[model samples]
Target: MEKNNRVIHHPILGDLKFRSLINFKFNEKVYSGFEGETIAAALLASGVRTLRCQEETGTPRGIYCNIGHCYECRVQVDGVLGVRACLTPIKEGMAVRSGEKLPAPFKKEGDA
Candidate 1:
């Protein structure tokens, strides 16, 4: 079998392995994943392509940039929307859903 160029093998990082398996919900479906891995990475490993929707068009989007700059990989984690999945670490029992907008911050009348 041939290897894909986009695939990566870390020599020093070597055979990435994790023992602890945790359960989390993604888009209302229960998924088992390991701790210490980014939510995006875990989802990608699990064949989850689309993460959230675009703001304007409401079209589905996924991890265009694995790094945290693009914001395409946003997901709702534990009721918080627009949380960057690429930056967030996967936790056990996390309720993750996909959407576009972030939960609006509460603003006091006199504060602003």
Candidate 2:
């Protein structure tokens, strides 16, 4: 974690060691994360909460279901939309950004 101490050393999980360090961008800001970790995990470890926006109201949203079952962690990757952060692995020099104009869950699917 960047000077903020976002990543914690877990007693059970042990020290989260990484094989290599990867540099990525979030909202155009440079960030560092460990390779082989999920984008959502990396971001969370670095203290990023909001991952996307609710298109209807423009409200900020973030990770909900860590697994792929829910798409709540949707983010834009390299200018592509609808990339799920929780499922997407972080790569060196990857560009990630909160989903701009991403519609609210129900609204996007026309749910009642």
Q: What is the TM-score of each candidate against the true structure?
A: 0.74, 0.81
Which candidate tops lDDT? 2
| Position 101, candidate 2: lDDT | 77
Score each candidate by Cα lDDT. 0.77, 0.83
Q: lDDT tens string, model 2, 11-36?
A: 79977666687889999988777778
Lowest-scoring 10 consecutive residues by lDDT in candidate 2? 1-10
Candidate 1 structure, TM-score to reference? 0.74
Shift in Å, residue 92, candidate 1: 0.7
Q: How well is each residue in 1-112 modelled by candidate 1, as lDDT tens digits?
A: 3111222457787665565877788988877667777888778877888887766567789998889998878888998777899999899989999875444346557865
